[model samples]
Target chain A: MVAKRIIPCLDVDAGRVVKGIQFQHLKDAGDPVQQARRYRDEGADELVFLDITASVEKRKTLVEMVQKVARTLDIPFTVGGGIRTLDDARAILSSGADKISVNTAAVQRPEFIAELADMFGTQCVVLAIDAKRRLGRGNRRAETGERAANVESDIAREASPTGDPEVWFEVYTYGGRRPTGRDALAWAAEAERLGAGELLVTSIDRDGTETGYDVDLLAALAARVNLPIIASGGCGRPEHIYEAFVRGRADAALAASIFHFHRYPIPVVKRFLRQRGIEVRP
Target chain B: MMTRILILDYGVGNLFSLMSAIQREGAEPLIRQEIPPDPCFDGLILPGVGHFTPVSERLRRMRSAIDEVIERGTPILGVCLGMQVLFDRSEEGPGQGLGLIPGAVVRLPDSVKIPHMGWNRLHLVRSNPLLHGVPQGAWVYFVHSFYPQPEDESVVLARAEHGVSFPAVVGRDRIFGTQFHPEKSGEAGSLMLKNFLRLCRG
Candidate 1:
């Protein structure tokens, strides 16, 4: 039986691990390789390096960072952000990225998903969808500072899968700063059909909030797709991880802040889940 | 003597990770994209990625060169698409594989995910030097859809279940194949590489 994976998403900017990743033996917060190696030693099943700085000038730095991380860590690593075209994906993969995540680019040109999948195996392509719950009447913008695009009128809003009007979430791009107006669950299904190997669903409203994962959203996406769904956003506690699997039925749980701040070491979290009877990779 | 393992770079798969893993094991990695005239290396590693036919096409011209190494009983280890290319053919794309091993690479049942990506535990069905010190149920990273269905069942070294019980590790004589990427599978994978290096030393 495959065990549920616990992943720590490391944000990379300007060729450096941006945030302070305080592992039990974290040598430095700036060294992505050391931080990743520490997480691997602490029982992280996989890792994701999100290149927050997707500038053309920083692309070369990110590629080198990917190679360094690949040589330093043994766990499977996925690189996301700025992977817009096939060449972009190739540059990362050839530099030793096991899998790549395409968010805005895939949403803009839906065929980009299949094109990358056709080049690399589908398993190597993970479709990252940012979904945010729509409030009663406000559609201001995402606070994540991502660029906004006027895609709200592209698709008509459908009935929420849960059949609750207040529960509907619209898909967003550019780090959840822009609303694409696409139904979150509907768009996730479409990505899978387009040959996405996995769905990385992040709750824009809950992201960086660290209250807990959006269980309702994850549960809905998990129910709609057969592929492995990784529940991201709002994991403030180890129990939240357990809840993601038990309640959301997510195949994997990804958290950034909790693990980044050393609030709970990955081994401690895995032990907590294991004691609670979740099959996690030891 | 440093065990030298020749890694084939068919212009399909990236050899950096594989080469780095080999170097970490204290073995000399000899990489060549072009087929060499002599199988002078102590062992051979076929590291691959991409669709079956395109990758297989890269291996076609090097078939006779590869066969010469196999005929010499030089230890060879193939990972992912590299492992699939050892089979007679594949369902992924049209074309014949190297046919070094007797089997057809078939698509995994649709009941499970296509790529079968992630870290899955291995159940050792039989003993082999490649799995020397590795524990049973040791987790290894897998990322592929098709698996080799060897005509000879005894070739299976270990098995893992997704939708069905598929061969995770297969061995025939000195020819070995791991459907997963040993270079990326952490400690357990490193041990497997070390074991393969030991076989090369012999």
Candidate 2:
């Protein structure tokens, strides 16, 4: 059986590790290499380094910083942000990243996902979707705080004949700054068809809040697509991570705050999950 | 003398992880597009992260050279798609594999996720030098949509199941292949690489 993955996401600004609430109010966390090594030592299954300042600042992802961090760990590493073209992705992968994730550029041109998957097999192409619940009139469930009875209802609404979902997750781009208006679940299915081997679905509304993962979003996406989903955003506690696995059906749970702030060490979280009968790496 | 391992690049994907892992295990890793004519390195690794057809086409160009390396008794370790190419062919695309191992690659069952991405346990089939320190049911990382189906079951040293049972590790004499990425498999992977290096030392 494939064990559920516990990934530590490091939001890098310039080159240092930083954590922000809802992708704003950035605060320096630690050095990227040091933090990455610490996570590896803590028994993290994987690491994701998102150069938060790259796309917004028009600066390239720090290749030097990526190389430094990649050299310290033996596990898989994924780098994202500022990866607009194949050359940009090549630089990061060559520097040692096992996978390269694209968000903003991919949303702008959905074909970029196929291009990346074609150039570098789908296995290494990860589509990072930043989605927020649409609380507008069309999504009454969000406004009224009405949760779907289960994943089945969420799927039913997503596939409703009217095609106007009462509740929908809107895809966001530019690191959660711009809403693309694309339904998150629909985009994920399209991404899978475009050859994306995995989906890193991050909830922009719950990002950095440490509240919990958008289980509805994750469960909905998981049901819609066969690709492995990595649940991101929220995650205040080990139980939250567990919820992402059991309720959300996420193959992996990615967290930054809890891991970065030492609120819950990876081993502690893994132990917590293991005790709950979750299959985790020992 | 320090063991030197030549990792065939093929311009496929990232070789840094595999190279760094080997270096950490006390082996000097040299990257090259083509296999050196002489068995200069103690072992060779065909790193994979690309489509089957393109990668197979790339490897087919060095077929005779690779065969010569194997003839010289140099161990070759193929990983993921690299392992797929050791077979006679693959269902992923139209191309001829190295055929060093008599088998064909087939798509993983659809009952599971396509890529089968994540860590899974390895069920030991039989002992080989590659399984030296690896514990039974040890977990390893995998990221591929297809897996090899060897013609002879004797070659299979270990197996793993996603939706169905499939060979996870196969070894026949010096040539070995792992469906999983040992380089990225954390400790168990490190141990397997160390064992491969031990084989190279001899």
Q: Pick the candidate with the highest TM-score.
A: 2
Model 1: how far residue A150 lies from native, Å = 14
lDDT of 1 by residue, B124-143 (tens): 99999999989999999888
TM-score of chain A of each: 0.89, 0.89
Candidate 1: tens digits of C-alpha lDDT, residues A1-282: 678999998878877776422211122246788889989999999999988784788789998998898877778889998789999998988888888999999988888999988887788899998888775323433333322343233234344555565557777787766776566777787788899999888887777777888888988887777788889988889989999999998888998877877989998899999999998889
| Fnat for each predicted structure, in order | 0.62, 0.78
For each candidate, the DockQ is 0.62, 0.76
Prediction 1 TM-score vs. true: 0.92
Candidate 1 stretches with Cα past 4 Å from truth are A20-29, A135-159
Candidate models: Cα lDDT each: 0.83, 0.86
In model 2, the runs with Cα more than 4 Å from the true position are A55-61, A136-157, A160-165
Q: What is the C-alpha RMSD of each candidate to the true structure, in Å?
A: 3.9, 4.6
Docking class of 1: medium
lDDT at residue B23 of model 2 (Cα atoms): 85
Error of 1 at B3 (Å): 2.4
Steric collisions counted per model: 0, 0
On a 0 to 1 TM-score scale, where does candidate 2 land against the true structure?
0.93
